[model samples]
Target: MTVQPGRRLLLIGSGWGAESLSRQLREQTNPWQVTACSGRQANPTSGADLLLWLLQEAIEPNALDHELGLWRQQWPQTPLLLVLPAQHRYKRQWLLERSVEGLLDQPAADAIAEALEVLAAGGRVIELQPETTSQHQRRGQGLGHRLLCSGVDQIERELEQINAVLQLAPIHPLQRFVLEGRRRELRMAREVLHLLWGQEPIPQAQASAPAEPLQIVLANRKGLTVLHTVEERLAHAVASLDEAQPSPLLALEALLPDRRRQLFEALLLEFRLLVERLQADPTVASSLWSGQQPLLRERALQQLVGAYTQLPKEGALVHLGDALVSSSDLQQEDPELADLLPSLLALIEGRPLLIDGGLQAPDEPAALLHLQRLVSNWLIRNGELISRELLNNCSGWPELRRAVLLPDLLATRQLDQLRNRINSAERWHTLVERPLAIYESRRLLFDIQAGRVEPTMVCDLRDAELRQLSWWQQAFTLLLEARDALAPQVELLINRVGGLMVLLLTRVVGRAIGLVGRGVMQGLGQGLQNAPSSGDQRS
Candidate 1:
């Protein structure tokens, strides 16, 4: 299919995807005669009516400027359209100075098509205009405001450079801290400038947008049934434990041997008081279950467990108890603890009783099961309250919705990992052993409970590196651009010269040689006609 003369378009580079922009353009209904080439291969002789520059790689402003200059010289009358990446930091004024007719950042097909139509009709288009009317008004208020705005812009640029370095390079932790501190200072300065200029403080944009709420699906009846059964067993165990422990002193006496009961009574009482304090508050139980309110939980747990264990202080095994109580005192006070220490530790870690090298005590298993049930019930009862607390902390409904629907948006592999951690005893034990793993699990669990969802965070290292430019780097870039900018012009000149040389060889030299050969043939013919035949001479 032949396109009209004006519809010819030369696509300079492949777009963001695997497919070339030319192919994508051809697929559209615009009937454009698309010619695709890499940046190195582009030349003036393409006879294209429009030039579309697709900049997928990170390019410095000076480099871009030089390239644009070369393109403009090559195709003086052709309209230039630039398609930049969404995160490109190129200035609008720079592009306008180069006479770019149209600009689109990470544009869709429809947007690209519209821009093309507009450019073809001698119109201009630029999508990224962040300057608002209010900002313009503020900028024009006075010289002081203008000066402050300039200072703010400089600080922002510095911050951008620092951030780019942090994202693109792996630096020492100390160096990273220094860089981050510098960024904070710059941010403070920017804020002060904004205040002085009477401009509204800019809201910090979230790194990742909140994920959309996932559609609710039918519940798995079999899974629910299993959960219900586990709940029933846990409830039964709790009731039994409650019956066994009519009072804290009596419970301690039952659990400890007679010889050591008096020696550890005071310590046991203190531990019991701490546990009772935490247990009495419904919020603590809910927080523990849902992994919310970490500060509250941490402080409360510290008094009983020496800032680590969830168990009462007195409940720690003799060897495990530290500075608060001597190991010798604990051992002398309770010899029976030697036999039950492993079981108590296992329960605290939330490990199953049936695992290899795990706890074998029937009472300890019952106690662990009862604790689990108690925490779960507390969470169930206060679920709405916790949800409300979580929602209240979010910026808006979108954030809350993202929190609630996070699990549904997780990839299959991520979902499988979560399931394994929950269902497999081995996985759970492994997770418990790793502090980082436990912290991550708690964070994820908190998000699930709060009903918040966010997209996965990512950084384009190339883009980041490209954005970080120093004075020397800019100078070096200009030198490189000078070399690159000369390449096409040199090639074009050589091509024209070569074409003329070929014409001289084919048209002028060949014709002259043909004429000489024709004259020789004519002279031979004339000589034969003038001379007598051999047969006639013999007669």
Candidate 2:
């Protein structure tokens, strides 16, 4: 079966009102798309795509088992909740009561829409029909379109907020991001995809994204190119993240405080947001791959290992480039990534970065080198430590302070085995317009050390936030002291020789001083005497 690019919701019942509902969805798309199929098709379709097998009545056990097995393959950990029509009693409380992932009944347009939201969030659900639930009438609880619409809108809005937050965040390119920073990548990706929607813009957003002419052309041609490319490479790189965990091994909601439901909501928002951004701007793909911090993110630092593997020229240049550049940072006494500085400024300016232009003789090394060095140095220093925490105060070197807190070195094992399968930079070309920009790298490294890695897994997400605040507080203190030190010195270079001239004339009594007045009178008389003598001499 061809894999659909969207949230694939396959409906498998030809008869009844489903036909009408499908048409309605296609006609007025506030929710999503509908793809319907027959309930009983031979060699049933697999579950990588969503499988909506309508069980109006009892089916052959063999067929049911087969569907179940297929579901296991598509998303094994996620549970499939069964939906049932309440009146058709089967006396199988075991089936009804058993812990399934989710539940649905009669699935009207609203129900279908809600189900899609659940599915997109990686929610556990096994949609059941009236027969399965043993119900007669087609109503468990009626849903109002107004209510469902509002609910979906709120979810979408939250997603928008998350998307903004994620995008605003400084990040490594996608490839290097996954390679060097797994948790941050997941956090960013999850937030981005969570903001996607169909009919409207992100609600309650301070800045409603400007509407653009739909990229039907771009979506069809380059979009297809981008999608296919991103998919293939992502699949190749999946192994690195497999152990690394884009998320927890368990459902986010399984943890606590309404059982991680809030976390799940946030993650859902993130996923939609990412999807929307990609749809809106596919150029971000390049940044995703090239910020090659993971060095391990791909099999080799070079994404196109196979294509350019034998072309020793590119490989040699890049390897030599990295070595010469990174070594410069390593040997410096001050931790300044001078090389990658231009890349940082360009990133701030939001301009396209041309890796090779041969435009002019170089006056400076590239700033991308600085970022790369920063990441590599972070890795090496981290590798030497045992825990995230270092055992010293060393307040002057903030990175070192952060290093002691993290488990020495990056968690390389988390990157699954799929790294070798990826062999091209073409996959990431789509996202390159926005080069990854990491801010406060030293502090982030410190946070990694300090056990404040990312989106809090436990209900205590606030703790991570506090830890971040504390780091900034320390940094601010340092800056504040530096500010005081740098202020210009003042010794009040005062000479009082002209001090009397500066006094207020109103305070004068010499225009108030009687003695000063007499001296002025005497000088005036002398001048009068000299003027007469001058006239006589001239005659």
Candidate 3:
């Protein structure tokens, strides 16, 4: 009697023993036509009788689930025969629940063929051994638990560092408040770790709250569950590091009583008004706040306003600019004005305007009106440029706009003073202007040599060496070096003495002479009035 042909079987795996399996099935008396493919390349085909998925050892549960889902989607009606490792017999129930018709433990070619035949014949076959807890699984679980413990230890170390800073470091009150809030978050993260470790029971309040359905499969290796939870919690903790924490200062304010709270509120109001006033005039703000004691200035501001406001520690000026933009009607007039305000504020504050991770130029004509208004307001209130010393130190945008605009703004008030001196009959400009110019030149040269202004451009004097020259040239160069070194000091002295002379002439001498002239004129008029008139002489 002739044997009938076996049904078609689709073999899917990593191609490890797929060819051998296909050959073995083909050599059978009633050979089954086998089509082998990798898991990623497996697709539905017409007249596919059965699917035999050879599961790799140590395969992640998520990956297996994803493969199984793809198999189901491609072949909804086709019977599935899963060839699992003996170690993964624990996953039999999971495979069965996922609508797998057959499960075999590391099945050989004949066994796979038999399982496929049974599945094709509409019968279920489960050759896997009953679920058992092995030593290897216990070791894996122990390692996972240790890893979670290590993560908890790491978090504890970070918390300890924060506590050390709070205890030992001389930090701002606002920094203290922020650090305390971070401490609370770390503490909460520690609680989560403890709960996951099963060392602590869930709180009654939290237990009473409705819990989300557990997505983790119990049939999956316990170690894998622990690893997944650890990964999720660690990621959450890292994300929380960047998130802004709630201010403890606000909580302290909340705890204060009515009278003190009212006083605190008033104090905060005054601080806000002060910040607004400072923002309105960058000159006064820079003079008062931008100095050697920046830390103290920031701390004072934080102590005053941290309770009511959430300002970033680094960019307090930017925060003030944001507030200014929000309070103005510029946004109402034009939507783009709101966007342009930040760039404008940065320009006036002598900071670089960044857009899309690059320096941006403020070349828009529409911004001109607003820029002019801001500058005019500053000038009308007698605001001066942020100290040239500060400007020389900061290497901001080197664009033509900044280079031109800043110098022009500086020259406005300076030129006005120069004009007044030139118009004076005293001719004080001869002595004052030249000394001031020399002092400024010397200062600029010093700044350039010290690597403050125009850092990319090297100073000619910086690399010059008298030793490299001939003897005569060295003598002349030595004189030049000494002169170069002493010029700044000499010019500074001259500038100071010239300033004193100008003050003496313009204020003391000029006021005294005007007083004397007014007195003489008054006395002469009184004498003439006291003298007898012509009519009185005739009488």
Assess the local accuracy of residue 175 in candidate 1 as a C-alpha lDDT between 0 and 100. Answer: 86
Instruction: Give the runs in model 2 whose Cα sits over 4 Å from its true position.
Output: 1-5, 28-31, 40-48, 59-82, 96-100, 125-539
Q: For each candidate, what TM-score against the reference?
A: 0.25, 0.21, 0.25
Candidates' C-alpha lDDT: 0.47, 0.36, 0.47
Q: Write the per-residue lDDT of candidate 1 for residues 207-269, one digit (tens) a residue.
A: 222222111111221222223333443333323332112211221212222211221222233
For model 2, what is the alpha-carbon lDDT of residue 248? 17
Q: Sort every candidate by lDDT, greatest first.
A: 1, 3, 2
Task: In model 1, state the lDDT of residue 422.
Answer: 34
True-structure RMSD, every candidate: 35.6, 28.5, 35.7
| Candidate 1: Cα lDDT at 430 | 36
Give lDDT: candidate 1, residue 522: 99
How many clashes in each structure? 7, 77, 0
Q: Looking at model 2, which ten-residue stretch has the lowest summed lDDT? A: 212-221
